[model samples]
Target: MTSIQEKIIALKHKKNALILAHFYQTMDIQEIADHVGDSFELARRAQTATQPVIVLCGVRFMAESAKILNPTKTVLLPAADAGCAMADMITPEDVKRLRAEHPDAAVMCYVNSSAGVKAECDICCTSSSAVQIAKSLQEQRIIFVPDQNLGAYVASQVPEKEFIFFHGFCPIHHQVKPRDVMEAKNAHPEALVLVHPECTIDVLEMADFVGSTAAILDYVQNSPKNEFIIGTEMGIVERIKQTIPQKSVYLLSTKMVCYDMKKTRIEDVLKCLEQDIHEIDLPEAEMKGAYKSLERMVSVR
Candidate 1:
């Protein structure tokens, strides 16, 4: 093993740290991670981890989530500057203002948001659980924050619950146009289109399957078909290749890359493990408040 790889492994053992990487993370980071998954899956794994320190090989919002889920454990984001546009799109004040406009509506926040936004919302949800969470809420009107695409998708599924969506989207996924999906399908005629809910409605309409990153991975693994056109971040293609090398998978658009997710390199992971700086620290009250929404999400699942 190289020095960086050897040192990271050594430090992880020494610090009792478990590295959690998102599906969008680079292949190197994913390979070194003790657990590699999407945001919701990583958070779930972090909750059950026996390690005292958790290193997140993902974006800032993901690290914040790990901190919220494991308050007692130290959560570190290898690339401190790595942040999601969707997460930064809304704030606590914005949620409050929207809440005022629709007093009877429940606030259901996507997990791609920040700790502060989660604290303000009534309940938090992931792409996989959004439809169920929104449906479970007794409120007829729901204010879904920080991703209109996901909100719209969930609203379509649970039509009984009316949704007031927030104007936010993943900068990377937003670039994907419907024509791109068409072109990809034209090239790979037999391939099935699998898309994430963050994708635009136009792209979603072209998809044969719609779900979260974890859900997408699971679909590709279990499906009888051997070919797919993935409609999310590009990193997932690498992940799928690793998991099921025999299957053929193609990206709907090459522009589906998330620079924020790629920011956390193997070098950053090694440096983070060695220095142990950039630890995620939420105020006790902030953490406690956010935990309620997140905890409620888990309970429903």
Candidate 2:
């Protein structure tokens, strides 16, 4: 470890802080994180944290989620400006409007949304739990928000329900076209294609596997196949290369990078711990509202 990393560890211990990172974070940040996982996993970790201070090494929405889960704790976002484009694509007003139009439908907000949006929804879900959550809902009509791609994927899995999708999407994942997958496949014909459900339905249809970042990692680690094309973010590809070196892993597209997730450096984490900067604070009402949706998500089996 570098001197900076050692310093971060020392400061974390001094401050009684727990560092949580998303799977899309840089390897350096992940190395020092007490827990590294996808959104759902990190939220669960945040909820169960024993420490008073929590440093989240991902985008703003992730830090917000941590704060919502652990309202009493100090949740610090290392990169204050690191925001999710998809989260900003929709608003509480939009959710209200959708709910009015589909009164019979239950609102299911993706975790990739603002706390305000979550407060307005009936329940929240992450990519990994979306299908199960949707299936578990009592309402036959579901109004899924933020990322239409993920909503569509969940809808496909639970065909018994009717889904009303929003126009929002992950700009990075939405950029992947079917031709891009075909090109990658042609270059590595023997490689099995693994993609995130955040991709468009057409792209996901071409994938041999569709899962969250953690699920993708687990699949690659356990699968008997030796060669794979990872879809999702470039960080996952780097992680795969580092952890599963024996497997020949390739990125499905070079354009799969999430700029927001890449904003936090190891140095930023050190500064966050030292100064406790970029603390996440939400209105009490919003926190309580979002908590209901998120708590419901966690309670799902």
Candidate 3:
């Protein structure tokens, strides 16, 4: 029986492929990936890649974004079902309705959303870049759609600008209770608490550091503290452990897994690579529209 790693290496050579993974992917997938980052960083990397294929190890929307950016290159996802619930919250129809209500506000969609939703947006942003993107827009009031927690977090950071938020959130991050924070703090008083801004405002308030997955990785790598509590997905703990063998990492809660992110496994990835099946396609017209939003984000940042 061939291991997934062996197959991945074979596929890389055969197809001249680049595997881009998300932080929420399994440790095995991360180990096999050529690049591992959040949505924004991965999209940027995909845009400049010389490779013919981009094997995205994240959710469906992420692969769709890669397809939108690198229209010429073939983009494949391990599992078509791997998706984000937060991204699923808002649709193009929902955005149209919201725009009808507030014609004056410009839509700033989060990259985690579907391509159809992104096509409706004036610009797009990730958790790390949301503040900067929101600040760049001075033309009109901003309606930040999808993840309200992220929207609120960006709003707090850039209070000079007002953001009208859609009532939506990440279920995994939203489930983190304040009591979990207190408990983790009680257990590891010296450990720094690194959090994802997709968490609720109260959780953000309790965090010693509130940022994206990439930012959290950088912080843990550079922080003076030898111990930390991570408030994102559980997969991150494995990555931290592998990188910083001496340090201790804890999850704020054991229930931090995103089933959607976990849906794609090693076997699924290998099958997709071998068959070159389940390709993600963005309509030429929709790609053009979505790329405009994405480009506005890339150029401004």
Best by lDDT: 2
For candidate 3, report its TM-score: 0.97
What's the lDDT for all of these models?
0.90, 0.95, 0.90
Model 2 residue 109 CA deviation in Å: 0.6
Name the candidate, 1 or 2, with the larger lDDT value. 2
What is candidate 2's TM-score against the reference? Answer: 0.99
Ten contiguous residues with the weakest lDDT in model 2 = 235-244
| Per-residue C-alpha lDDT of model 2 across residues 1-301, encoded as one tens digit per residue | 9999999999999999999998899999989999999999999999999999999999998899999998999999999999999999999999999999989999999999999999999999999999999999999999999899999999999999999999999999999999999999999999999999999999999999999999999999999999999889999988888888999999989999999999999999999889889999999999999999999999995
> How much is 164 displaced in model 3, in angstroms?
0.7
lDDT of 3 by residue, 76-107 (tens): 99899888999888889999998898898889
- Which RMSD values do the candidates have, in order? 1.0, 0.6, 1.4
Q: Flag the better candidate by lDDT, 2 or 3.
A: 2
How does each model score on TM-score?
Answer: 0.98, 0.99, 0.97
Per-residue lDDT, model 3, residue 186, is 100
lDDT of candidate 3 vs native? 0.90
Q: Quote the positional error of residue 55 for candidate 2 in Å.
A: 0.2
Kindly report which residue stretches of model 1 are placed more than 4 angstroms away from their true locations once superposed.
none
